[model samples]
Target: MNSQVFQTPIEYLKGVGTARAEVLKKDLGIFKYEDLLRHFPFKYIDRTRFYKIRDINPELPHVQVVARLTHKEILGEKHTKRLIVHAQDDTGVMELAWFQGIKWAEKNLVIGKAYIIFGKPGMFNGKAQMAHPEIEPYSPEALKGKGNVSLQPGYNSTEKLKTFSLDSKGLQKLVAILLDQFAREISEILPQYLLQKLNLMSRVDAYRNIHFPENATLLYEAQRRLKFEELFLIQLRLLKSKLLRTQKFKGNIFGSVGQCFNTFYHDKIPFPLTNAQKRVLKEIRLDTQRGVQMNRLLQGDVGSGKTVVALMSMLLAIDNGFQTCIMAPTEILANQHFISIKQLLGDDFVEVALLTGSVKKKDRKIIHENLENGKLKILIGTHALIEDAVQFQNLGFVVIDEQHRFGVEQRAKLWRKNTIPPHVLVMTATPIPRTLAMTLYGDLDVSVIDELPAGRKPIETLHFYESQRLQMFGLIKREITLGRQVYVVYPLIQESEKLDLKNLMDGYETMSREFPLPQYRLSVVHGKIPAADKAFEMQRFVKGDTQIMVATTVIEVGVNVPNASVMIIENAERFGLSQLHQLRGRVGRGAEQSYCILMSGGKLSREGRIRLDTMVRTNNGFEISEIDLQLRGPGNIEGTQQSGVLDLKLADLATDQEILLQARKIVEDIFARDPQLALPEHQVLHYAFASKNAGLSWDKIS
Candidate 1:
C-alpha cells in the first residue's frame, strides 16, 4: 500500500509497536505517517565539546562535561527518593543529582565509567551540581560527526503525552520511518521555467527539508519555497474571486454624477468644495458610471476631507432616485455622519435619518415605516443598519466608513441587502500602503486622497523623556491658556500601580489636583468606563465644556474635538507609530495651530527611537503606516478581529510587497496564455495551486 494511505497512528508502521506508538501519539501530535513527516524541530542542541571538570563553574547555566563516574550513592527516605553521583573530568569534579527513579538513574551511571553529560550547571551547597541532565552513553555512533549536528527537532508534547512515553526522539524515529516508506515522488506543481526563474525548490523537496533539513542553507531554501507557494496561491485566489465577480455580477450604471456636482457647485452648496474633495469625487463619479460594479476603497489621512466625497457619492444615488446606506462601526460615528450629511444635503431638502442600536422603540418604528415607504432617501446607522426588519426602498449603493474594522462576511451581508448587489464604496482614515491595498483588495478599485485640504495648518510634534515632565506640563498649560483644550492620554498594559506608569486613573487624578481650577473643567474617559459615561465625557470635551480631557488610547479613533489643540501622550514609547499619528490627528482639525508632546520613558530602543523620530518629522499617516509595517510586520495589523483577510503564513506583506506584484503579473500572464492550466507544462502549476488552496496541510489552524 502507498505510504500516504496509512492514515493511522505512527505506531502501526512496520517496526513501531503499540508501546512506542503510544509514546509517539502522546508526546507528538503525529497520528499518521504524514503528520510525523511534517513535525519540524523547534531548535537543536549542540553537544560536540566536553569541558574538564576542574574548569566547570557552578554559576554557569549550561555546560558540556566529559568525565568518569567515580561513584554513586542513594540518599533520602522512601518517601523522597534521591540518588547522587560523582563524576570527574580533566578540570574538576561535578555532582549529579536525581530526584525520582533513583534506582534506574544509579544503574545508568556505573562507577569508573567515562561518559558525556549535557545539562545546566548550578551551585549546590557551594559545589557544582548537574541535576537529571541528558546523559548519553559513550559510543562512536552516539558521537558521530562530533559537533556537526545542526538543529535537533523538539516535538511539542504535554505532560500527559510525556508520561505516556512519547518524546522528541520517538517522534523523530517515526518521521524517519514515514520518509523511508510512504513518502512519494509527487509531481512538481510549479512550472520548470518558473521554478528556475524563481530559484525555488520543488514541493516534495521543500516539504521534506522544511521538516528535516540537512543543514542551515537547505532549511532557508525550503522556507523560501514554502513562503512563495503560500503567497502565489493567495494571489491566485484573489484573481479567481475577481474573475468570478466580473463574469457573474452585473453593475448598475447611473447617469454621470457630474450634473449633481454642477448643481451643488453653482446653486445648492454653501462653501466651495475643497480641491482635494473635488478630485476624489471625480474619481468616484468615474467609477460609478463604468460598466463594472464600482468596488472602490477610498483612503485618506485623518482630517483629509473624505466625508465630503462620501456625501457627494450618496447624492449621486439620491439624485437618481435610488437609496443609499452609510454604515459606521459605532453609534457615535454613525450619529456624527448623520449630523454632517444632514448639513451637507439640507439645501436639497433630502430626508436623512439616523438609526442606531439604542434608538427608542417608538422612533425605530417610525424610521422603519419611512424607510420602506421610500420617504427616507439616505439612512445612516451602525451595524443596526443591516437588520432584517429595516429594508431599504431601493438600496442602490453602500458606503462603509472605517471599513477595516468590519469583516468580509459582514461587508458581504450588507451588500446582499440590495436585489442587485449595490455599488460599494469603502472609506477609511487609516492610510494603507498602496502595495498592500492591491493584494488585499485586488477585487476592489482603490482611490486615495493624498492631499489635505488647503489652509490646514500642519500639526507640530515634539518628543520628551520623563525628565522633561515638568516642562511638558507647562507647554500643555500654555496651550490651555490660549483658549485651546489639552488632551492627556495614558498607556494601558496588563496591570501595574507602583510604577504608576501614567495610567488613565493616575493621569486623571494628577490633572484634577495639579491643574485644579474653578475655570478649568477636567473630564475623564477611559476604556474601563461604561460606554454611556465615556460618550458623555467625550461629548463634553467636544463641546468645550471641559478644557482638558484625560483619556486612554480609546480616543485613538473617533473623538473629534477640533477645538482641542494640544495632545500630551504619556509613555509615548509604548504606543505604535500609526496610533500616535491618529492621536495627533485629533488636534489640528480646526484653524488653531496644534501641538503633540510625546512623553517617553527614560531610554528608548532603536525601534522606539525611530517611531518617535518619525512622529516628530512628519504627520503623514501613509508614511507612518509604511514605517509601522516595516517595524512590526503584518500579524500586528491582521489580528483575529480583522477577519477574512489573507492571513498569509510566510509572506511578509511589507517587505515582500514587490513579490506580491510579481505573483500577480505571473498569474495574469499564465492565465492569459493557458486559462484552464490544461497545458501539459502548466499541470504542475495547477497541482501546486490545488495543494496549497486545499488549506495548507502543514499549517496548524489556530
Candidate 2:
C-alpha cells in the first residue's frame, strides 16, 4: 500500500460497498480511506478478561461473559418487534434483547449456542439484562481476535448507520481491517529530530496505538502526541499570522507630544492617573512610536479607568496632526462618551463631534464636512461612524469601546477608512480570562488595567429575598434623599404568566403608586422603546430631572450616571455574572458610597447561589470572570463563540491553559530559530501548516 491506496475511496475497502459508504459519509463525514483512519476513538475498553454472568452487576461499566443461549423468541408486532434471547452461564441467566436490527439478529442468532456476549449490565424488572449485546461464536480464535493486551476501541455511530449493522462494533471491525491491511501507509507528519527532542512517539505508531493501544501507557502517550500536534499547529498559525501582519501593515507615527496632550495632562487634569493606568500608557506610547500597526486588546474590569486611557490615546493622535474616532456599541454609550469627552476637553483646542443613527441629517452633513476637512479632532459615536458616507482625513487611531458587540466585518470597515490601517485600541470592560484571551484574541497584544483609581469606593453588593421589597425601597428612598438618583433594573420588560420574574413595566407602576407624581419623578426605558425615547429618559436621569430610571439590560454596557448611588436589580439571578457586574458598575461612579442590591426569589439553584455568593464576596471582576468561565465553559461565554477560534476537537482552552502556554512558547522558539520555516528539518511543519490552512486566507480585522 502507498499514497494512492491511502487516497482510495472507503467504499473500495473490504466488507464496505456503495450503500455503506454513502451512509458512512452522510452520518460521520467519512469519505476516503484517510478519513476513516483520522476518525479517532473517544474511549476504549479492556477485553483481556471476561466476567461471569453471576459476577456481572449494574454497577459495572461494561462486561463480557461466556453464555449459552437457552431460548430465542420474537415478540410484539411491526415497529414494536423485539428479538429476545435468554442467555445462561453456569451460575446465572440474563435476558438479551434487541429492538433495532431485530430482523438481522433473529436471522443470525441460533438457540442453545455458546457465545461470548459483551455489553453493559443493568437491572431491568428485577432481573439482570444485556440489551443489544455484541455476540460472537465461542472459539479460541474468537477469544484471541478480541485481543490479549490491546484495548478495544469504541466508535460513534448514528441510528441510520446502525440500521445497516454499522454500530460501534461494526465500525471498529472496519478500522481493524484498515489497520491490518495498511498500517505502513499511515504516513509520517512530524520530523524525526523534533519527535526525538520532544520524546514523542512516531506518527504511524501513534496512529495505530491511538485506535487500539497495547496498554493504558501507550494510549496516554499517543493522546499526548496527537493533542500536542493539534494545539502546536494552531498556536503556530496564529503567531505566524501576527508576525506577518506586523511586518506588512505600517502605522502612522505620532512623533510629537504636542500642547493639547501636555496642557490637558498638566493643567486641566481631573485626577491623577493610577500606577496601572500609567503602565498601560507606556505600553500604548511604545506601540505608537514603533511605526507598525498596533492591534491591541485593552482589558479592564468595570470602573477601572479604561475610558481615561482611551482618551489620552486619542489626544496623542490629535497632537500628531491626525484625526481620531471612538466607536461605541450603542447610541446611549456613544452619547455618554461624547458628553464625557466634551466635558473633559472643554478648552478651545480640539473640536469633537458625535455621530449616531439618531443624529439628524443636517448635523451629520456638517460632521462629515468637518471630518473630511480635518477640522474635527475627535468623533465619538456608534456603528453609523463606519458607513460608506463617513470618511476621515488621516484617521490615525481608533478606540472601539465594548469591542465585542461589533462584528469583525464592522471593525474591518473602520480599518479601511485609512490607507494604512489606523492603530486599533479595542477596549472591553468584560475581563477576559488569560486562557480565553489566548484563544479569542491571540493575534492582538493584550494590556490589562487591574487596579481601580484612588478615591473610588468599591460598590457594596448585597443579596435579599423578594419578601423584603419594603426594606429595599426604604434604602432607595434614603439614597434619593441624599440628592442621588437610583436605577431600578428589572430582567424582563413585560410580565409573563409562565415565568416567575418581575417585569419593568409592573415595577414602574408599583413605584409610581408608592410615591406618586412630583414626590418621585421616574423615567422608563427599555429595548422595545424608540431610541429617542430611551435617550430622553436616560438624559432626564443623567440631568437629575428623574429620581429613578427603570430599565432592562439595555443599560448593561456604558451608562455613566455618577448621581445614581443605588442600583436595585430585580431577579438578579436571571442575569449572568458578567452582566450583573456591568450593571453594578452603572452605580458607584460617584464619590458617595454606592450600593447594589440583588433581589431574587427565595429558591436559588446551585449555580445561581454560587454567582450571588461570588458577587457578594468580591468586587474583583477578574475573579468573577474566572468563576463564570468555570461554571459555564468557554462556548457559552458571550463573544468568543461567534468566531471559529474555539472550535477545538482535542485541547480545551479552559483546562489546558498550561498546555496552551507551552504550545505558544514552542511556536515562539521555532520562529526565533527559523523565521520562514524554510529549512529541510522544518519541511514537515511547513506541510502541516499549509495543509491545515489550505484554502483559508489570513486576512482579519486588525
Candidate 3:
C-alpha cells in the first residue's frame, strides 16, 4: 500500500472537512485516509432491483422503490410527531416517514417528482411504512457512481456521527471520494504468487469489494481474503513470540524430581492421579527440562484436579532448591489453598506459608523473611504477594490461580520479582474453547485436564420455573435430610427495575421463613458483607454447621464444600453460561451425588432457554464453552475481554477454527524454513508486520 497516502490525515480527504474529520476521529477512530478505506461495511444491500409499492412487505429485507410522491404531511404533536410522505408507484402508495430531519425532508422531497427510496419496511396500523429511508432524485445523475449491479455498503456509526451526516451512508460517500482519488496508489500487500496460490483477490479489489461489491461472488471472496489475512498475521505474531521466548528467555532448570514430588505422589496423594493429570504433568516436566522459561495455561473444570496438578508443579520447583508462590484472586481462596495443600502434603513435607493483608504484622514479617532467605519452600497469598516488601530469594516457579482475574500488568509483576522470569503456570477453572485459547493465550503452552477424578459422579442439573417452587423446596428438604448441606444463590444485593431477580438478602429472609430458626441453621454471604463475616459464614457452611447457605455469586469461586449436595440458583437466567457452569461446579465435589437446581421466571429469552437446556443436558465444560463462545462471542469470555485483542475486523474465533489452524500450520512452516522471516519472498510480510506493530509488546498477554 502507499505509505504516504495511508498516513495522511483524514482532514485532507475530499469530502471530510475539519468538522467532519473531528467527528470521525473521535467517534470511530478514523484518523487517516486509509482508515476510511479499511473501514469495511457491517452489511450490504443489493441496489440492482427496485420494488413496486404493492410488492413491498415487512418480511422482505431492505427494499428499493422508484416512485413519485403523491402527498406529504406532518402528523401528531411534540415527541410523537413525524413527517410522512406518501409515495406512489404503478400499483399502490407507501408511507415514507422521518422521525428526525423533518425540515430537510419537507424541503428536499418534491411532490409529484420521481425518486428512488430504500429502507426496511415495517407495518404501522396495517399500512407499509418506512422510517428514515434513503431518498434521492430518480435522475441517472443522482446515482452516477452506483452501478446497476452494485451492492451498497452500510457502515456502523454512532448517533454523534449521524448529527454530522457521517452515518453509514455518509461514510460511504467519504470512502467513495477517497477511492476515486487514491485507488491506484493502494498497492497490494499480499504478493502475486501467494495471491494466486490462495486464489485471493488483490488488496485494492478486496478493499473496494468489501465496501461496495459488484456481485455476490466478489463479496464472498473479499470477505474471505480479509479474514484470512487478519488471522494469518495474528498467528504469525503469536508463534514468533513463542520462538523468541524459548530461544532467548532463560529459565531455571529443575534438574531433578526429588523426594517432595515423589513422596506426595507415592504416599500423600488423596486419590490416584487421573490420566489427564498424568499427561499434563508429563508435559510440564518436559517443558521445565528444556531449560527455557515456561508460560503455560492449565485449564480444567472445577474438581478436575487442577489444584493437584498445580501443587505438583510447585513441588518440582521446590525439589530443585527454589521457592515458589501461588497468587489467588481472593483471600478466601488463598486460605483454602494453604490449608488444603498442607493437608495434601501430610504435614512437614515442605514448609508452606500463607501471606495476605489479613496476616498479622509479626507473622507477615517472619513470612517475608523466610521468603527472602529461601526457607519458605512454597508460599500462597492474594495480591499482597506482589507488594514491594514481599521479596523472594529465588522465585523459580509461579502459579497464578484464576489467572483471568489478574490483569497483564499484575501478572507481569511476578515475572519482575526475579531477574529471569520464573517458569510460570497459570491455572483457571474456566474451560476456554480451543479456538479462543489459540488466539488469547496462543504464545503459552496449554495443558487441559479433560477428565474428572476417578469415581466422581456428574452433577445432575435441572431447570425449574417459579411455579415449581414447591417441588424445588421438597427436593431441598430431601437433600438436607440426607445430611448434605445446601446452597441457595441469588443474583443481586438490591432489587432494580432493570433486573427483577431476587436479591441475596431477600432470598435469605425467605429461606429463613421457609425453614424457621431452630429447624434449619442458615448463613448468608454477599459482596456487601464484611470479609470476616463472609469467611465466618463460609466456615460454618464448610463445617456443616448450617444446613444451607444463602448468598450471591461471591461464593462462586471460593469456599469449596464437598458435602454441599444441592445448589439452588435463583434467577439463574441472569448469569452467563460459563458462570452458571462454575456455580454448578461448587457442588458435586464429593463422593455423593449432587444436584444443581436452576430456577427462573417462566418467560426466558431465547438465549437464556438455550443456556438452561445446555446445563441440564451435559456437564462437559468444553462443550458448554463452545456453546458459550457461539452465544456470547469471544470478548465476553473471562479473560479475552480485557486484552482488547478481540477487536477483530473479520475473523471470529468461534467460527473460524479451520482458518486459524491453517494459519498456524503455515506459520510453523515459515518459521521452520526462515526462523526470522529473513527471506526474499518474506520481506513484504516482515514489512507489513513491522508497520502494523511498530511498538506492540509481544508479551502483553501475561
The numbered model that scores best in lDDT is: 3
lDDT of 3 at 467: 96
What would the per-residue lDDT of candidate 1 be over residues 1-702, giving only the tens digit for each residue?
232354555667876778756666665556665555556666555445556766677666567776789888888788876888998876678899999767778776778888778788887777789888777666556556432233445566566655644566555655666666555633355688989999999877886676567667787898788767667777676676676686677777778555655576677665666767777788877766775677888989998878878877887877777788899988778878887777766655677889998899999999999988888878899888878888877788889988877877778887787777888899888778766676667667778888877768999999988888889878878888888999888886234856547767767877888788796899888777788898899889888888998888788776677788999999898888878888898899888789999998877889989999999999889998889888987657533235344566456778777777787788888877876667878765544443433232322211
The local distance difference test score of model 2 is 0.85
Index of the highest-TM-score prediction: 3
Over 4 Å off in model 3, which ranges?
Answer: 68-114, 122-132, 137-149, 691-702
Give the C-alpha miss distance for residue 319 in model 1, angstroms: 4.2
Give the Cα error of residue 124 in candidate 3, in Å: 8.2
Over the stretch 525-563, how does candidate 2's per-residue lDDT look in tens digits? 899998778878888888899999889988887688888
Q: By TM-score, highest first, what's the ranking?
A: 3, 2, 1
Give the Å error, residue 310, model 1: 2.4
Worst 10 residues of 3 by lDDT: 693-702
By the TM-score metric, which is better: model 2 or model 3? 3
lDDT of 1 at 337: 85
